[model samples]
Target: MTPLLDLPSNREEAWRWADLGGIAAAAALAPVAAPEAEFLDLPGAKLLFVDGVLDATRSDLGPVTLGAVDPGEHPLGRRASQGWTLRLATDAVAEPVQVVHVATGAENHLAAAIALADDAAAQVIETYVGAGWSNRLARITLGKAARLMRSVRLLQAAGFTSLREEATLGEGASLVTTVLGAGDAGTRIDGAICLAGEGGYAEFGGALLTRDAQRQECAVRVRHAAPNGQSHQLWRAVAADRSVASLAAAVEVARDAQKTDGEQSLRGLLLQRTATVNLKPELEIFADDVKCAHGATVGELDARALFYMQSRGIPKARAQALLTRAFVADAMERIGDETVRAAFVADADAWLERALQSPSRSREGLGEGSR
Candidate 1:
């Protein structure tokens, strides 16, 4: 068993904004059996995991193999006793696959690996739910000219949930990822994208919503190791009722990575004075010929915009919801599948409605000076 001290803390630069105490508490508790809960109503082939172990009775794995794979060097990943491995045949095109993880134990760990052969293409959707401390690790490898699209949803966890994914792209490979986080717990997502081959491309879009003292954080690092590689990161976060949302994004360019194009945009919205949003964007470029840029902004809802909408006969709560929805649309648009995108957007909308309806002392001065 891993020691409690092995877990990351605020002293670490990468975990400076994380909930270390919550993580420690969850890790110290004893593991329990999976609880009873209804699975999400998602379409296509699916794999269900209960308490970090695959539940074959409730899963339809389709073509994805069920076995162990390499769990990287992460401290939590090393403790994973079970995992799944997925591989695509060369030049093959496959349908979408869904992977759902439910954590009801005091401590749960899972690992996953996805590899695409040359010229192969595929899409995957991952969902996380249930309570307790759930830690996950995933490693992805794309062969030459391979393409992969992935979407992740972190929803309705009542305890600490952490996920870390590392992806490496080969020559001419392409990867697109979209993430949505709206959990009622402390959630953390760490992503590392490495463009290891020339002409590789990677794009990431994420939307996060936190309310009622919940916390959500996403940290991503994109490394351009070869020439002509391009990567982009765009993220939006919304916090309400003393909740906190944060994003830490970084881009790195190797000395030999000429003509590398890297861009990052991080934006946050605070629904109340007590709510907090943190954004950090960093660029480390060793190549003088590369083009890398990053931007971050954190602010409250536009008072002028709300006043205008109110003057036009829209109620204050309704107007706020509409504005927040629009703010999250950019990240939703990154999803290529219309059906998946719509479902994620609907989840965000529902969360917003619930947050606005709940009475909270933090929202006391909502429109005080906004005449």
Candidate 2:
């Protein structure tokens, strides 16, 4: 029998590029003590899952289906994660769902899933708290004709590591996944995005900031299974001190999947000479009537821009933050929803300012950290 650790924890692919197993050990469960709830400031339906169990009392709700669940072993009685049988088929106008995965005190693996009704629309805010606890694995899914806009933010105290994120979108479905990472802890996130729909679209974006000996890694895959599907991915990282990071994005457009449009880019800014970053952009196309391209760039911050900002009344710290925000602002700005764009950009800008002031920035390297 295969050991549990080798069970495709769904995090291995991203880890393949970076050594994320920190010297610290992992806890078996998250704390049961009441944790201060940092309600996501956005307006939406919220759910709070402490550790691996749903905390009804702590949760902000929209009706509750209280029960125990396991991804490897489903409580609803499923042998494996698969099929349209698991998701809905009717079009749905989805309100945002904010999920707070908190490790109050104990530690355990956390897993969650979502099956959208066909033609449904949803926005999800996924956050992980790294406050002196061990937490691993958070998985989600979207059904046919469903639309999802998601963001995963990690703000843990130093010393955390290991994250497994998996998502699958069916026919005529669309998904946008974004991540913002920070802290002195060591952590890694593995992402898998599958496009099973024809004429569907998927956009994946993320940024990471690290300091000290902290380490973070991200691996993403977008597969075009049906004809005329579209996908684009952008990932960036900023490291300081003796920090290290790795990111790779793989896009596969299957044969017969005609007119597929895909593009991916990974770029970063190194703040210090000790920072280390690795970026790999890939495209696998078996279709003849498709357009696909990928590339990676690593370099230092623009000195001229920095100098220009300093020449003005702007302080160096704030100026650096502005540049960092500009690095990823275009991506966020392009989002069509005015409300979503405004709120998300505000949060992103705050993160960029924090990254610039962290003092762990690398002066020489490639990649910019996201706010």
Candidate 3:
């Protein structure tokens, strides 16, 4: 029998607040057969992966090619049994592409690569569903003057999910990423972006919602390797019922990367006293001409706002749900596709309903901390 892969320990900065024990337990289970495919109602071309393998019957790959990815030596890469790659030609504009991963087994690993030529533009959507452990690695590259918009949704009902994304932008290139994660089990996301050419731009916005002892962590790093690069990070997390949610974001500017503009904003809301939310924002700038700023805040819902709503005849639970939805609206707006955005919002609303219906338990003080 093959030995299990050693997962990251809590000592690691990225995994410090992750549920490593739960991840390990899920990783130990053997891979099972792929479950029947139940596709989502998403527009544009679609590629469906069932249990880490491509489902040809259900996938309309268009320009995407299968068996083209070269998974490296990373732990997730080693476990990946299948991969896919997509490339856009110069000046080409294609309809949105959606990739869905459905995990029915105990362990599943997958890899994907996306690239755009000069002046090309495209939108991509990635969705994860079903149970078990799903580990995915994605690499994205943008040529000079290219543009790409990417969105990720983690909608798994159970089991752990891990995703790592690495994106590089060229001169005058642009990349925007929006993520909505509402999985019942634990989730870990590691993202890195590099502005390799002058005038490159990258933006990331994410909203994470956890409840019922669930946990989620996201760590992202943006590096300015060239002059006149710009980047921004925005994240909102909501935790309830003893759950924990965390976001650690960092920005680094090289010594010669002058005129770099970077900003980070992180906010967390706790619904119950036992719940925890952690936000850490860091910046290391060696360029004197750069303008960089970071801010983080963690607290419970505003009692004043709740009271005001209740005073106006709104039920307490309904008022709480309304406030929570409004809190994450900014991040959710980052999705460029209106239809996709609406679908995401509907999912979030459902999660909020379920979360608010649960009885609240009171602890001593607010379980909120930020750095």
What pairs collide in candidate 1? none
What 10-residue stretch in candidate 1 is worst by lDDT? 362-371
Cα lDDT computed for each candidate against the true fold: 0.83, 0.64, 0.84
Q: Across residues 1-371, which tens digit of lDDT does each residue of candidate 3 receive?
A: 22455766678776688777667766665555554544446556788987788888888988888875666565554565468887999999888888988888587788888899999999888888877888998888999999999888898877789887888999999999998987686788888899999999999878999998899989899999999999999999999988999999999999989999999999998887678899999999998999999999987878777778889999778888898899888888878788789878987898898887755432332222322
What's the alpha carbon RMSD for model 1? Answer: 2.5
Estimate candidate 3's RMSD in Å: 2.9
Candidates 1 and 2 compared: the better one by TM-score is 1
Could you report the Cα RMSD, in angstroms, for every candidate shown? 2.5, 5.2, 2.9
Poorly placed runs, candidate 2 (over 4 Å): 1-14, 23-35, 63-89, 132-141, 334-371
lDDT of 1 by residue, 184-233 (tens): 86888888999999999999868999988888888889999999999999
Would you give me the overall lDDT of model 3?
Answer: 0.84
Candidate 1 deviant stretches above 4 angstroms: 1-5, 28-44, 361-363, 367-371
TM-scores vs. true structure, each candidate: 0.93, 0.81, 0.93
lDDT over C-alpha atoms for residue 111 of model 2: 46
| Decoy 3 TM-score against native | 0.93
Candidate 2 lDDT over residue span 1-371, tens digit each: 12423323335543465542351333323344545656655675677766556676856665224333344532111222321112224665655667776665433454455667677776767666645444444445666678877776676654455555566777777888777775555566666677776777889877777766777777778888889888888877776567787778899988978999898988876766577888888888888999898878877668777778879989777777777777766556545556656655676666566556554343432233321
